[model samples]
Target: MRISFSEWTKSGSPWVWLNAGAVAISIIMVVGLLALIAVRGLGHFWPADVIQADYEENGRQRTIIGELVEREMVPAPQLRGAGIEVPEGVEAMARDLIKVGNRDFGSADFIWAMDHFITHTQRPAMLFAAERLEWGNFYGYLREVKEAGQSVGRHTGYEKTQEYLTLWAEFQQRIDRVLDIREQILSIEKKDIGSINYEIERLRLKERSLDLEQSTDTAAYAKIEARRSELNAEYEQLQQRLTDLYQQINRDTFVAEIADGREVEIAVAKIVRAFLPNDMGLAAKIIHYAEKVWEFLSDEPREANTEGGIFPAIFGTVMMVILMSVLVTPFGVIAAVYLREYAKQGFITRLIRIAVNNLAGVPSIVYGVFGLGFFVYFLGGHIDDLFFPEAKPSPTFGTGGLMWASITLALLTVPVVIVATEEGLARIPRAVREGSLALGATKFETLWKVVLPMASPAMMTGVILAIARAAGEVAPLMLVGVVKLAPSLPLDTNYPYLHLDQKFMHLGFHIYDVGFQSPNVEAARPLVYATALLLVVVIALLNFSAIAIRNHLREKYKALEM
Candidate 1:
C-alpha cells in the first residue's frame, strides 16, 4: 500500500532517497559516456591483428588482407535494400567492416563484406602495415628494400617476414633522419622566412608613411633597403640548404607486395611508421600506442585533420579563452562594483540588471552576427582606415580574427560575471564598510580596501563560470576567428609576438570538421570521439586552475567574509 503524503513528508525519507537517486543517475550517465568515448577513441591507437580472408565477391574468389575493425548484424531488409539477396527464413546477416588500407591503390581504405560469404579467415603473422604521410595506411607483404632504385634485399614467402623486419630497423633510422631534416626545413621556411616577409612589409608601410608625410629622409630609405638586401641573401642560403635536405631524404625507397600481387615501391621519406601488428608483443604494442598518442598531441594534422595531431586547435582554444577572460574580468568587476556600491538604487538600475540577466539567455549565434557586423566590419573598418591606411584595399583588423573573437566571447560571458560579482558585493557585511569609513577612509577607499577583498572569492567563482562557458563555445568563434585549419598560430615569433588579427583554429570547430566535413567517415569517427574527449579534459583543466585560485582566495578572506 502507498504511504500517506502527510506521513511521507514527516518521515523525509522519500525526498532524501529521491535526491540521492537523481544524483546517482547523473553520476552514472556522465561516467558511462566518458567510458564509451575512452574505449572507442583510445582503442584506435592499439595494434590489432591482421586477418587474411578468402571470400567470393560477384562470382569471383579473391583473397583479402586487412585488419578487422568492426562486426555487426544487419537486418535482412537492410541488406536487400542495398541489392544484396538474403536467403528465406534468415532474419539477419553478419557483416564485417575491415580496414583494407591502401588508399593510393584503391578508392577507399575501408571495406565492408558479408561475413557469410567468407570461405576462410586467418591471422597472418607476416602481414605488414605502413602509415604514410599521404593517402593513409598501406597494408601488404614486404617485397624488397632499395637505395637509389637499386635492390639491396628481397623477401618472398613466409620466410620474408624475418628478413623484412631486419631491413625495417634500417628504414626506421632513415625515416628518423628524414623527419628531422624536414622539421628543420619547415622551421626555416615558416619561421625565418615568415619573419623576413613580415619585416619587409613593415618597411614598405613605413616608406609609404614617410612619402605621405613628404619626409625627405634619404638615409631612412637607404637603411631599410640595406636590411632587405641582407634578409634576401640569408633567404637564398636557406633555400639551398632545403634543396640539399630534400635530395638526401628522397634517396631511399622500399617495395611491398599487395594482396593482388602488385608490387609498389614507396619512398622511405613518405613513411611515418612501418610495423607488423600481427607479430607485436604486448610491450611493443604498448610502446606503439604511446607513440601514436604523442603524435596525435604534437604533430600537425594531415589528411583533412583525420590523421596526425590537433596541437594548433588546442593552442587556439586556450589562447582565445585566456584573451576572453582578460577582457571580460575587469569590465564585469567594475560594472558590478558601480551598481552594488556607488549607484543610486532606482528603476534604471533594476532595468539594467534585468537586461543583463536577459542577455545571458540570448542566442549565441545572434551575438556572433553582432560581433561580425559591429566589431569586424564597422569599427574594424574605421580603425583600419585610420591606423593602417598604408595597407588599403586589403583588410587587417577589418576582418574576423583573434582580437574580435575574444572580444565577442567577453561580451557574451560578462553578464554571468557581473551577476555573480554583484551578489558577492551584496554579501559583504555592512559592518566592514562602516568600520573602514569610521577609520577616516572615504567611500571609495572603504569599498576598495574592505568590501572588494571580502567579495573577491565570489568574483573568482564568476570567472570560473565564465571560463567554463567560453572554452566550449563554437558558433560565435566560427563567425569570428575559428577556421578549419590555420597555417600559423596567433601567437608566434613574429613581430609584436602575439598577432591579434590572425585567424586561428579551435578544437570545437576541428571536431565538427573532422566528424562531418571529412572525406573519410570511418577513419574520422574514432578521431571525433578522441577530440571530444580531449575538449572535455581541456575544459576541466581550465576550470580546475580557476577553482584552485578561487579556493586560495576564499581561504585568505575567510575571516573578512565572515
Candidate 2:
C-alpha cells in the first residue's frame, strides 16, 4: 500500500497533461472562431468612408467630407443631372425642399442622392444619413412614384423604370425578330414535313411497283426495292431537318420570353448589384430585413413574397417546435417518472438507461434516414393506404413536410428530455415524496403535484438544449421539411390553417442555399454569413430565454429543495 509520491505523480502525468492540452486547444479554437465571425459580421455594419460634397461654412469652396454615408442614402445629383431632363414631379419636390429648408425631401430624394453619390463621387456623407432613410419609406416612395406616373430621383425609381421600359421595348423588338425567324423555321419545318410525306408516298408507289414487278421478274422487283430504299433515305433526312428547325424555334422563343420578363431581369440585376463594389453594412441589411419581416407579418402577401421572405420559415419553425415539444414533453416526462419513481433498481432498469443513453449518442442524420424510411415510407404508407386510399401514389401524410420533421426531431430529442427528467426526479429529496404519501396522498398525486413541478426546471433545460440543436440542424430538416424556397407559408389563409404537410424554409437552409446553390456565389457570400449569424443569434436568444426561465423557476422552488 505504500506508494512513492514520485511514481504516482509520473503515472498520472499523461492524463493531466492531455486533458489540459485538449482544453487549451478547445478554448483557442472557440476564441478564434468567435473573433473571426465577430470581425466579419460586425465589420459589415461598420460605416464606409463616403466622399460627400459639403459646403463648409468656413470655406466657400465645396470641400469633400470623407464622412460615412449609408450606401443607400448618398444623393446622386450627377445621375439626376444626367440627360438634362428632370421629371416635373421630381423638380416640384426638389423645389418644395428649398421652401422647407430641404427638410421634406423624403426617401425618393434620399435614394436618388444615395445612388448618384455612391456611384460617382469619392466624397461620402455621414453614416447617419443611411440610418435615417427607412427602407420601408423608401420603397413606399418608389410605389408612390410608380402610381403617380412620376420619376424617382437620381438613378433609382424612375431611372429603373426607364431602363426596364427601354429594355422591355428592345426585348419586344428582339421578340418580333425572333418570331419572324421562328416563322421561317416553322416554314422550313413544314416544307421538311411535306417533303417527307411526298417521299413516303413515292416509297409506297415503289412498293406497289415492286409487288407488280415480283409477278413479272426478279430483276424488276430488285430495282423497285432499291428505289423504295432511296425514297426512305430522303424521308429520314427531312425528318432530321424538321427536328432541327423545331429545336431552333424553341431556343429562340425561350430566350426572347426570358428577356421580356421584368421580374427575371430584376433578379438578375440584384445579383449584379451584389457583386458591385458597394459596402452594405450589417445594420443596414438587418434594418432592411426587419422592415421585410414586419411587412411579411402585417401586409398582404404578394407574388414576390413567395420567393425570399422569412415569414414562412419563421412560422414553420415556431409551429413545428411547438408541436414537437407538445408531443415529446409528456412522453419523456412519463418515461422518466416510471424509471425514477416506480421502477426498482434492477438489470432491466439499467438496460433501459443504457438504451436511452445510446439513443442520445446516435447521429441526428441517422435519425433523419430512419424517419424517412420508417415514418414516411413504412408506417405513413400504411396509414395513407388505410385512410387516404384516393391519394394512393402520393400520400399527404407520407410526404416530406413540417409534421414529419417535427416528429423526427422529437424522437431524436426524447432521450435527452428523458435523461434530464430522470436526473431531476432523482435530485428531489426522498423526504418530499414520502411526506406527500404520509399526508394521505396517492402515489400518482404525490408524483404529479410534488415531484413533477419541482423537476420541471430540469426538463425545461433539456427542452431548451434540444430546441437549440434542432433549430440549427440542416441535415434532418433537409430530408424532411427544409426547402430552398417554399411558395407559400405553412400557415396561410387556407382551411385548417396549420398545414403540417407543407414544406418550409429555415435560416440555416437559407445560408446553404445562398452559399452553394445560388447562381452568383460571390454576391451571396455576405448574405450567407449574415444568415448564419442570424441563426446563431436566434438560437442563443432561445437558449438564453429558457435559461432565464429555468433560473426563475429554481428560485421560486428553492424552498422545496430543502
In the order shown, the candidates' Cα RMSDs to the true structure are 1.9, 20.1
Q: What TM-score do all the candidates reach, one by one?
A: 0.96, 0.55
The C-alpha stretches of model 1 lying farther than 4 A from their native spots are 1-5, 160-162
Kindly give the stretch of ten consecutive residues in candidate 1 with the minimal lDDT sum: 158-167
> Candidates' lDDT values, in order?
0.89, 0.58
The superposed Cα distance between candidate 2 and the true structure at residue 494, in angstroms, equals: 1.9
Candidate 2 worst ten-residue window by lDDT: 267-276
**Residue-wise lDDT of candidate 1 within 373-414, one digit each (tens)?**
999999899999999988877898999999999999999999
Q: Can you write out model 2's per-residue Cα lDDT over 1-562, one digit (the tens) per residue?
A: 9878788788898689889999999999977876777565444433333333433222233323223323322123543555333434442222101000011222122222222222234321111111211111100111111112223322223233565444434433434554565556645554555445545554555555456445667676677678767767876876676676555434421111110112111111111011001234666666655654454343322222222335555666667777787788888989998999899999999999999999999999998998899877787788877765554465767778888898999999999999999899889999998999999999999987888889989999788878877777778878877777676667754445677877887777776776777653433454555556667777787778888988988888888987
